[model samples]
Target chain A: SAVISQKPSRDICQRGTSLTIQCQVDSQVTMMFWYRQQPGQSLTLIATANQGSEATYESGFVIDKFPISRPNLTFSTLTVSNMSPEDSSIYLCSVVSFGEAFFGQGTRLTVV
Target chain B: AQTVTQSQPEMSVQEAETVTLSCTYDTSESDYYLFWYKQPPSRQMILVIRQEAYKQQNATENRFSVNFQKAAKSFSLKISDSQLGDAAMYFCAYGGSGSARQLTFGSGTQLTVLP
Candidate 1:
């Protein structure tokens, strides 16, 4: 198991503003992923952040809306751009290694 | 495409009693992994238990145990001596070995532990 942490646990941002959530892991990992959990809904995968390359977004998501950066193995960031009221949800980062994936203390973003 | 399902939207149980959360998944592959995660009001997702499809014996951890019915594609979690802390949203997840290690989570079941 890996200890994962996210910065700015909760934030209130105005519509049209962008917020970048940071995820830090205790050790190097091969794959990092981003997920969104809307109020009273199940989680949906946003993208897979791979170090040194662009992320692979899920079917309903796009890179322009959720830009991701995985500069290294132990850290990654997901920025929700041009936020809107519909974008209000908890953003989580996950890491997978040795067939096990762990989640961070999600970032609760409230867009007003 | 793989999908996980938690049919029960919410469940309630009295403290010190036992409760079971049901989960079923659809998959074409033979080998995979199943997991149950607990999310409290604090909203932190915590791993409760896991089971590997290839393993015939069920997996158990403390008060948490799983009934893995491979042929039925069912993975249910049983909490013994349920505590108030067990009140939360529980999510069922599925992941396969190899490069396809991404987890597919089910709609959560909110468990309410009453005193």
Candidate 2:
């Protein structure tokens, strides 16, 4: 298992502002994923980020709205741009290690 | 594309009893993995169990076990002698073989363990 440190744990942002969530893995991992869990909903894949490359966003998600950066194997950041009430959700960072996926504590974002 | 489905939105079971959470997924890939993750109120995602699609035998970890049917594309989690700690949101996930094949999650089932 990999230890992931997700910053802020939570945040309260205005509708027009943006917030960046950082994910730091204890070990190097090639593929890291970002997910959005809306209130009372299942986790939806926002994007798949591979180190040293651009992220692949899901169908309903876009890079402009949810920008991802994978600077290295162990670090990645997801930015929620132009936040709205609908963008308020728990943002999670996940990594696949030893054929199993491990997640961060998650960032609970509240947009008002 | 892969989709995981969890029909039950919520379920309850008495303490020390047995409860089974149902999960079904659809995918075209032959090589993949299925997982059951428990998310407590703290929102820390915990991996409960995993079943490799190639393996016919079910996967078990202590009281948590999975009934995996490859042909039916069904995977279910059964918790025996359930405890209060087991109460949380359970999510079924699917992961295919390739790097481009991303992991998919089900809508989740909220399990309530009554003491």
DockQ score, prediction 1:
0.68
C-alpha positional error of residue B28 in candidate 1 after TM-score superposition, expressed in Å: 1.1
- List the global CA lDDT of all models: 0.92, 0.92
TM-score of chain A of each: 0.97, 0.98
TM-score of each: 0.98, 0.96
In candidate 1, what are the lDDT values of residues A62-110, reduced to their tens digit? 9899999999999999999999999999999998766677889999999
Q: Compute the interface RMSD for each candidate structure.
A: 1.5, 2.0
Global Cα lDDT for candidate 1 = 0.92
Off by over 4 Å in 1: none
Q: Which ten residues in a row have the lowest lDDT in candidate 1 chain B?
A: B93-102
Cα RMSD for predicted model 2: 1.2
Q: Write the per-residue lDDT of candidate 2 for residues A60-98, one digit (tens) a residue.
A: 999999999999999999999999999989999999876
Best by DockQ: 1
Give the distance in Å from residue A57's predicted Cα in candidate 2 to where it truly belongs.
Answer: 1.1
TM-score of 1: 0.98
